[model samples]
Target: MESRKHIRSFVNQTWQLRYGAPVDDATNQIIWSFIVAVLSLGAWAGAVHSGSLPVTYGRKKALLFNNVVAIVAALIMLFSRTAQSFEMILLGRFLYGYNVGLGLSVHLMYLGECSPKKLRGVMTLTGSIFIGFGKVMGQIIGIKELMGTEEMWPYLLAISGVPAVLQFVTLLFFPETPRYLYIDKGDAEGSKKALQWLWQEDNLKLELDDMQKERESTQGEKAKTVKDVLTSRCVRWQLLTLIIPCAGVQLCGINALYFYAFDIFRESGVPEDQMHYLSIGLGATELITVTLCSFLIDRAGRKKLMGYGYLLMGVTMCALTVMLSIKDLNSWVPYVNIALIFCVICIYGLGPSGVSMALPADLFLQAWRPSAYVISGTVNWLCMFLVGMLFGYIVNGLGQFCFLIFVAYTILSAAFLIYFVPETKGKTMIEIMEDFNKLNFKNRAADTEKTDVDLATQF
Candidate 1:
């Protein structure tokens, strides 16, 4: 186990550098955000205009078509022959969203399987940093050009392909996830070879043993079927605990504050032009906070940090909401809002934003992991889309009530953590499963006791 941990750590650290080498986190974020923003425009165009491509392609063909859609949209924008319309822009954004949704799920599963218990938290947190950094980068790029400029937006959207291209090339040389090769593909020899590549002359038996244990635990269970997830009470419970809180984490309004930092600044009465520059400060603080949390998460214990972090975020968000509500507030009101925004971002970075993604991947058994992750990822993106689309409307309609929603979510999330979520720190996959199995045993005992008491009363 110790040797496996060491090997996994080395592999994870190496892959982190390799994946980020060509573009780095900031650059990747910039590219991805630009694509998302551009694709948002394309989606709008498709919905509104009659000229766009038909939307009925099959899944495999649709995915390929989507990739082509980005290229085609980019070309249309770049050539500048056709008059720019919201429809064209919307098509690009819709395509980007589809691609991102798929990519995010696959990558999360890949990262979770590749990482060992010791370094899993930091590895997952790194993905979040890249995501936030990408958003900031895209915003900075967008801020440099006029929002409606046809030339810049398409190029920015297309730039995402550069990293995707590089990733495709790099993955060609890298070994597939050993777990995938061993279990899903049923290629024992290939799995051994991949483990050797990952460990590079380290103890291969240790890694194999770890994999064997995982396989045994998951064997004979109908974990692979979607019906298993739906029908099994324990599986259903685990799925809910994993997905609901993760979705709730996003629905708490943090993304609104993060994504629309500039809008928030403008609403707080900061000059519109200056909102972009001030957003850089917000991004910097977020990066710092995420970095700190990544280092501390494995050491501090997931539950303690998450529980405390949510509490802190709730208090800060509530205070900010209250400050925003006061009539004739001091000149520092905007700055206070920014401060509270920073605090909320920081607290979330320390907890939900960084930790929640890692938890479901950790808690679900290996056989059920990919399915659980699919649900979590789907819920995450769905909630994220919901918040991103409706936050402005909510704030406009309900005003301070929006903050109250966030506070309520934070409180409920904290309550969930305190009552049910277990600390995953330093626990192996088997150990974690054993801990959960113990919970099942205890519950069964309680049920039996209750039944006996009822029987005695009847007699």
Candidate 2:
């Protein structure tokens, strides 16, 4: 939503940018920047209401409804050119943001619920993989030779509708996640049928029993509200873990690094024409690495991947700062600088990019799951907007020293993970909560030393 929000401004040969803008210069700046920034706010807006929809409407149905947001948002853009109104563009961007914010979180929840624990890491992470693919596709389609031309601007904006359409059609055949049916709706027979269809197993006793244990753990608790999520003591550690990873994905400077990646390549004295292809190389590198992550996550474990990945990224950022500081010092410095930029992006993809996305679904049971997603989604989008809005100012103020901020964040986050973040690989939802409960009780030595709990649980 942020990237594609400026199609008209960047592709100035378009009719919309030439003479068709309905607004004046100040208004246009406000509208375009406002629209770009509003997408994240829109995501944050929709995210506030995300939990209610999934709990009340069911996960699949909520996502189906969200698919409509994309279709409508695209139609709004498709008509913006003909109507000669830029307000439609603003409206469209917001709706697009709303769809993605709502879709990504819910899809993760649904995918996590649908799969068995053994395959859950890879299954849930396909959400992040699909998102990476979308980013690449968006860039490819936005190329001026392709859909980014004058006549193609509106079509370029509306192309996002295609994925929603495809999902709407195919999602009909798949049942609601068996966990949702079983735990949320308390429908044993229905859940059994759904699980059978999804897992192709005649027996789901093992899975059902696990869900039952989870249900018992949250036995007296009502479905948590946003207020509930904030006020509840039991979920403190869970909330911290969720927020840390979710917010860390953005705050660790992934988006800011991508922004810097382009600048680094351009400043490397690479030709402008070749820079575009180099940009694609960077995207492809992230795509391949993140895709590889899905498979490796189940094998290597989330904490290890993230812990090591961030450590590497921290070292790379420090290296980048040195390179940027000394780019004029040597003939070969520019090339090495570009290589480190790609290396930073690659390390980002290998660990935090996908693993952080999976943390909510991995850590929470159905009772806390929806609320966890709401908080996770909200923190993630809000931090993204903060980084996007402030990083430019940050760069102006600190120059190359700005990367030291990221290094600081990595140091703090890595230390937090090592000391507190538990290894969640191969754990059931109930077991994961048990781990959080251990952390929640970590301060009280009186209650926990005799009780068995993972001492490494996240605070």
Candidate 3:
């Protein structure tokens, strides 16, 4: 335990340097929410638009294309004052949204294929950490007095171009995911070369064996298609398990809080002058908690961390709701609300925030992974949109009762996790499936024996 804690701490520090500042905490709440909502909404718009096109582009091509569009959008936003027009901004947001939806799916698929089975979960979480960091950095920039000027919001929105450029450039240097080269593209020689570049000679044989096993399992099945994802019971169930938790995570109201931190703090009684600094603290704490959770996720197992995290968040929200319901609405009420919000943030960062993003690939076999990712991503964004759109209305309409909705969702999330979600720690993808199969079997004695055997094998 001690060694694990030390390792987690070391990893947290290393990741912090790699990802840089998290999204800013102190930006004006209305603007922050608008930007996030637009970004998320735009991504979906772009996805639906591009998806309608019959382009048969491969993952790499798709990534490049998306980046190109994102760059173009960012440039337009940066240069022309007319770009600030709501309709034009929406157009730009649509393109960015499509890029995000497509890019996220591709990136996860690529990362899953490239990562070793042993480290896949952690690598997956790395992407989430970076995203959290990006959110924090954005919040920081939003709050800066110099940047907070009306002229600067466009620049802040355009800054996403930097990462898009880096991603495009970086792709040129790294080899394509070997599994994609071999399984999807059927370029065996190319796949071998890519694997060699990615892994040491000593590790290549073992890794190749795993890849071969995955390929064989997928061969007889229909090639991964959108149809398969929508139709397959296995794929559908996995998608549901992943999507519900992900949606639940968002509906916990973290994004709304993050997007509206200044407003939330203000409502809670924080002075306008100190809102930005407090927002910064919120971002810092989020970074810290997510960093800690990334290190512990594999060790602690997915189900426990997520279930408990939801429960904690739900409880804190309920407490805040009670405080808000009081007649006085005293200055202390805001402080308590802020404290509860922070607690919710910490729990979320430590568990569902990372795990929900990481688990789809962990649960699905490679053959189904791409489609699985697409479905999960679509559902994730849809829920994000739903929450972003409705949170304010709920808060305004129901007042203190608004929190009960989140509480209900959180409780539902915990129940689903405890009853339905399987533990996926320290097991190979194949082993995870096998364990899942055993648990699903109807014969109690046989299922028990299989479960015991699988658990023994994992250790």
Every model's TM-score: 0.77, 0.92, 0.81
Ordered from best to worst TM-score, the candidate numbers read 2, 3, 1
Clashes of 1: 17
In the range 132-225, model 2's lDDT, one tens digit per residue, is 8887887787776687676788888899999999999888998998888878788988999999999999978889999888777777777778
Ranking by lDDT: 2, 3, 1
**Clashing pairs counted in every model:** 17, 0, 13
Measured with C-alpha atoms, the lDDT of residue 394 in candidate 1 is 88
Candidate models: Cα lDDT each = 0.63, 0.82, 0.70
Give the winner by TM-score.
2
Candidate 3 ranges with C-alpha deviation above 4 Å: 1-38, 45-57, 82-86, 256-264, 267-269, 327-333, 439-459
In terms of lDDT, which candidate is strongest?
2
For lDDT, candidate 1 versus 3, the one ahead is 3
Q: What's the lDDT for candidate 3?
A: 0.70
lDDT of 2 at 379: 94
> Residue 304 error for model 3, in Å?
1.9
